[model samples]
Target chain A: MKKLPEWHRIRIIDNPVIRQALVIAGIIYLFWSMSSLDIDWVRVGKGFPRAANILAHMFPPDFSRWQLLLRGTIESVQMALAASFFGMILAIPVGICGATNLAPKPIYLAARAVIILSRTFHEIIIAIFFVKIFGFGPVAGVLTLTVASTSFISKMLAEDIENMPSGQLEAVRATGAGFFQFLNYCISPQALPRYLGVSIYRLDANIRHSTVVGIVGAGGIGQVLAASFSRYDYDFSMAILLTIMSLVFLGEFFSNWVRSQLR
Target chain B: MSIILKITDLTKTYPTGTKALEGVSFTVDKPQVVAIIGPSGAGKSTLIRCINRLVEASSGEVLLGNTDILSLNSRQLRRARRQMGMIFQEYNLVERLTVMENLLSGRLGYVGFWTSYRRKFSKKDFADAFELLERVGLSGYQNTRADALSGGERQRVGISRALMQQPDLLLVDEPTASLDPKTSRQIMRLIVELAHERGMPALVNIHDVGLAQAFCDRIIGLTAGKIVFDGSTRQITEQVLTDIYGEEDWSSTIRKIEEENEVGAE
Candidate 1:
């Protein structure tokens, strides 16, 4: 066997740059650990009785507010559906613009900037802003969810489009496929399944977010839950929490079923 | 025959300062199969791609018919590209699409976007596509997803898609590079037969010397981004092969079959 060349030999480095980075990271972790100092064993131990007392009062979920709860649940579902539908439709164009293959450099950069800005804030935060601008109710919640969903769906869709095989696109271009035709024949087919998957996932996420955005006076079950919490009605809060959990679980199940059907 | 495509002093230089094509020039008349053969990175692929403006030339003109293709706007370039069909080495079919859809993609240039979006091709285009599929021996596999097809089958689809365009010129870049020996021959024969049947000029970039010599009417040997030899198959002697490949050893590999044939005759 021939001897290996000196240039090909592996070597380990003991460098100051790596050591400095590790020291900085360790100091930051220490700072975080020091700031996490608000746990009181005695207070928690005493609070358990109060929690149990409240739980005892929450018997059978207080069906006196059944009509209100029913109305709120319906409104929440409607907000989620409207937001998801419009957001997904808008995401198609934004996602294409952000895709490196389809759009020119400037367009991709601009679309990516918009997606980043939209996703930076939580849906609840965006809902609060929209509530101030558009006034409270389902409209604000719908708008907030739409913006958040568009950001998430467009980002994922753009990534899916970017990762598609360039060979197919090149072949389509060689055939003299125009912009829309190239998208229709080459890009859409390759990215459709992934795009659908991301949209379904985003719909599930938006449903959960929509329920919470209503807590900030945007309308839905969240407003009622917040009102109950404010009145110190822990039992009512627990009931609402359970209902929200059930709704989220059902949404997840439905989303999974839809994804399977699409596949 | 009229000159269908002409290249004048074409040059392509990458951003990294590597020159892919260096003042290469050629004229391809109608109804001819011109094979470009060379070692890897010898500008054979670049030369073919430049013809269709897939890889834009840094300088010089590629005149297709009467128009200077390099000077055309995006719309005009697209219109010109519809007349030229390309086949790739990897058989770049949209894997998720059906083979029938892949063939129909060739007609996308002519069909309106809305119509193509609905996958509603005209009756004439559909009949032509089915005929081409039958010609390429993939009649029953039209509904098969491109991903599910074998390598040869995918390449067959690729060829059929090119034929679907009813193009004036066909450009094939290493069509048989990824196939086994037998399949390579079959692909070459199909390409030749299809080109002959259509009576269109076919510019094929091939790495295999035997395949090129057997299938092509004329062979243009490119080396270091320039055409070193341009002549008929009979003119591709050992000296010319040595000049193109830059090695005498390749001549031995090429001559071994002839030597065996002579021995068998004895």
Candidate 2:
């Protein structure tokens, strides 16, 4: 072969550190895969037929329970809206606490811990716990979604705060603006647009999650869907699924409108 | 005249082991434009930042009027800072905020939080902001968002904002560094003229030597974290420039002089 140029001849694999790290990662992955005991191809294959049958029965949806569907959907919308509003309101301070630039080390760490704890479990899992405490209603769904929204919104808001232009903050601080004044003049103005963007995006996600939290008896459309499914009324389940899809699409359209207004 | 600002043996060392300022000391008499000139990394930024306590001095006494600002608690420091107004090289106006809002931001130190939150400035503050905008030659641009303005216009707004504070002292760090020669001179002229109007002592850090000489009452030159030249503009000779910036070709003097003439015209 003809000689390659010096730049091309310089091999990336010549770096000993990267080569060693890749080797170690490969070895660990191989060992972990080999140590796994269960590989159930036959069970999954056997379950596919039942899934197909259920799916087939789910078609030609019956809209017999329109009143029940409407009530549950409205409840789910309320849960999502309440959770998003309260979550965003609470996130203002918590986000400031979590921002490395705004808070002291200990406060930032503690706020980060709060965010982590909130997001550690899925909203459904949180709904299960809240349902146990509050005994199954929109309250359980709202509270669960609230925690989930706060974690996501606060974390993202903190990141936006942290990433803001330091020059603007410095200029504001130099004017001798107090803590909240600095936030209002410097931090809030810059971060408001981005915060609104994130909150709207999170609201869309919360709407989807709120509809399903009812499956665990937290109270929403999912509860009705679960009941219909259990009773083998696949047609009603299909109707509920269509309604959920429509709600999601509506939520998306509303969020899009809000974003357009922000611009 | 009262000393508006007194810095005695100020020093700042960063966490990364960079000595930004070392035993720097200066004082500003009331109602004078004192310019600090130096090459990059010679503590010009650190010195100016130290004055407002934005970049805290590791060791120093920053006495503003009678209060030792370094000794003040956070609340007191904030109060003291209100009396001081700062402008930046990049104009640092909140991009999304209207020019009127940015101008009113200077009064944030005095107003209640809810006042700013509601964006309800006092009538006097609004009237003053409008007057300052007119004085700064930005009469019709109040509702314009800051990002929409040109560089010179933005700096004009910056000066208006600082003046809105009715500050006792003004600190400008490289206000003209990002601007063209003509715009730089315009900004320097505005800063100098405004400081004189308010009878507020001003400390300006600048990279351009001629602009400082043309606009400042006194020029303080720093090199390697120490003041090498502190004298009236007429007293600054080629020897002083050589001492502060080290040896460069003397032929550049004519270019600088021509640049100054062109800038002064604008």
Candidate 3:
């Protein structure tokens, strides 16, 4: 080579101008938002004595509400299971349709539309909407979580399918496998472990979502906790929080076990 | 020997306008083992795939047995595909599936959808699968996951899977490209012998002219998306190899011959 080009000598980190500008902008934006906020540290500080008083009253979580807590937790788990099962079943076809290599352009766009629509709203917002329609209960919780789970699972599953080796699909096609048959054999086997991995993840997410949906009067222990918080029954609220944490922990362990077995 | 597969003026032009096959036509009759030989981009794969309508011929008629396969509707094509089996250089067995499951997938066209889905294949399907496993010398490896297999073993499963279809015609695409020369010869012999035993015609797309000539009854040489030579293997000469490979060493051909003689002597 006669000489190294000037452009070749330019290192990526040579220009910190844009990076410095972004950091300055972010700092200014954060200060501006902080000024506009409703946070009052003095009020929060004053509430701590009340918090300590309630903390003292919370003496070992009341066993009187234990049966109610158990039933609520069981309902939440059932909702999670139902939503996960239906959502994952629906997601399989949607994921297949969204895969660019497998589905036609129109079908892929339609499947993507479903996923986008499902994902556009937060689970709590969807829960509120479903509660309005379904008149509040586990039904709304199930429906909301179903939409959330479908959106999450289908998008990731579609990506996994898109990444599968085309040769394996061709081999199945050469065997004369029809669309569903080919999906069942060639694509399913390839995508399954990943799907299971994602499904378990989604199940864990759905379980967590079930608890939040109850705050919107959808169902589960969250309704009781929200009520206790509103009524200033901080001890009962503490009990609910502890139960929710344990439930989440248990769900996580169960899903991890399922994922390990799948692997 | 009756006409098994008849292709007339087959052509494939990609959307990007790279013409892969230009009006290529050939016919396979009876149980003859034929190999299509050419350089890398000679459309050997395109030609083989076109027969099964896998690549979808831009313009052609492919008659498999008595039926013209190109005109078949989706449903009819699915039925028509049952009679044809394809083996790939990469083996293409679903890696997560068991070898037995891969073999049973060959009969998916015949099994009911639910039956196949539940993997509760018919007793006849199971029996035939076990028999094929034994025939392919993979009797004890049926329960083994396909991904666990070596290259040669995977191709053996690929072969058994194809045979499980009980196809009347077999399409092989560069079956030995990924194999060692010795393993290549063994795989070729397995395919040839299996074709003979099943009395089904086999069409192989191969790069090695020496291997093609050693096993195949007929050799069709393609160059740049067109057929440059089509003749019996006995009629092929070093000149034809020159026409196909385009000024590569013929010395490798001599070495291949000596290797074959040594194998024969052993």
Candidate 4:
């Protein structure tokens, strides 16, 4: 019988010396970053009791201002829906322009720039900016949600269009169809299901963000919740929190049902 | 017979320095069904695509009934494309659309954009789609989505969609590359029969030499971006196969054709 040569498993990095040096450098960096943070252990120890007191005051949630809570929640829901409608209207053209297969290079770049610009700032910051411009109202909240939703939906939609198989679109083009006609027959049908799914998910996300945007005086349930906290009205704040929780649960259930139906 | 399609000095060189086709040329008379057979990467698919400008030729002239297709601008090229019907290897149907809508999509060039967008095709287009669907043996499948059908059923729909254009010529690229043996023959027969029925010429790219010999009237064998053999099925000797596909034991391949000939003779 012939003797076999010894073998060894291959290393991820072929050079063992460089690999060891990289691992050591990474470990040292992790430890240095961890030790650099300033800690106030004594203050952390005092926070437990304060948190417990807040929880105790939050119990036995009051419903005395149920009508006011209801009105604030309705306003938030209205902002979410209106923003979703307008954002989707804006997103369709922007997504079409952003798709590498569908649009010219210059237009694709411009559309991508717009989406990036919208996504750079957080919704709360944008709401503050809009509040300063439009005064304290639901209008600012609506504008903030619209901008946020447009970027999210348009980016997802452009990726979906880009991932579609080119053969189907090529077949449509071979039929000598006009550009718009080809879009209507070929691109729309292929894109409809994914676009529907993404749009519903974004609407759910927008609803959640609408509540947060109102903390900056943009007019929603969150504003009421924030005011109650400042005034030490913990029970009323608890009622507003419960209402927000129920609304999120409803949005989640509705979005899931719609997505399943799309399938 | 009048010439329905002509190609003169067609060449295609990719940007990466791969020459896919070099100085390829051919012509088809009315009602003729020509089969292009070769090994993989032999420029068979590229030849068919160049005729329709799907893959732009490096330098060539495609004279489709006196108009040089490559010379036409975008608008004129679109008008020129209307006269040419192309079938693909993958049966590239929009999977989410219904069979009737896929069929009606062929008439998009003639109808207004808004008209087709509303799905309000003219009555004449609808009647034609129905008739083509029946002729392709898919009579009651108008409402079925393209993805729901079997492979053979999808190819049937693919053929019907191409015919719906009412084209003057047909360019088929590997129409049977994905089907089982029996389905491949059925599709090949269907394509040739339709071309004859319409009195139009068809250029088909195929990998199966046996099927090509069985269905097509003329065979063009290619190797390494050049045409090595162009003749009838009867003229395909073993030496010719070796020359086109490189040296090999071609006895089994040739014997199959003789057996088919015996069956036909009987």
Which candidate gets the maximum lDDT versus the true structure? 4
Off by over 4 Å in 4: A1-38, B262-266
Model 3: residues >4 Å from true position, as ranges? A1-60, B118-124, B254-266
lDDT sort, best first: 4, 2, 3, 1
Please provide, for model 4 over B220-266, each residue's C-alpha lDDT reduced to its tens digit, 9 standing for 90 to 100. Answer: 99898999999988899899999899899999989999999999999
lDDT of 4 at B258: 91
Fnat for model 4? 0.79
Give the docking tier of candidate 3.
medium
Q: What is the interface RMSD of each candidate, in Å?
A: 0.7, 0.8, 0.8, 0.8
lDDT of 1 by residue, A210-261 (tens): 7799899898888888888789777667778878899899999998998998
Model 3 chain A weakest lDDT span, ten residues long: A5-14
* TM-score (2 decimals) of chain A in model 2: 0.83
| TM-scores for every candidate against the unseen true structure | 0.91, 0.90, 0.89, 0.92
Which scores better on TM-score, 2 or 4?
A: 4
| Count of backbone clashes, every candidate in sequence | 0, 0, 0, 0
Model 4 residue A105 CA deviation (Å) reads 2.2
Checking candidate 4 for backbone clashes, the offending pairs are none
> Among these predicted structures, which one has the highest DockQ?
4
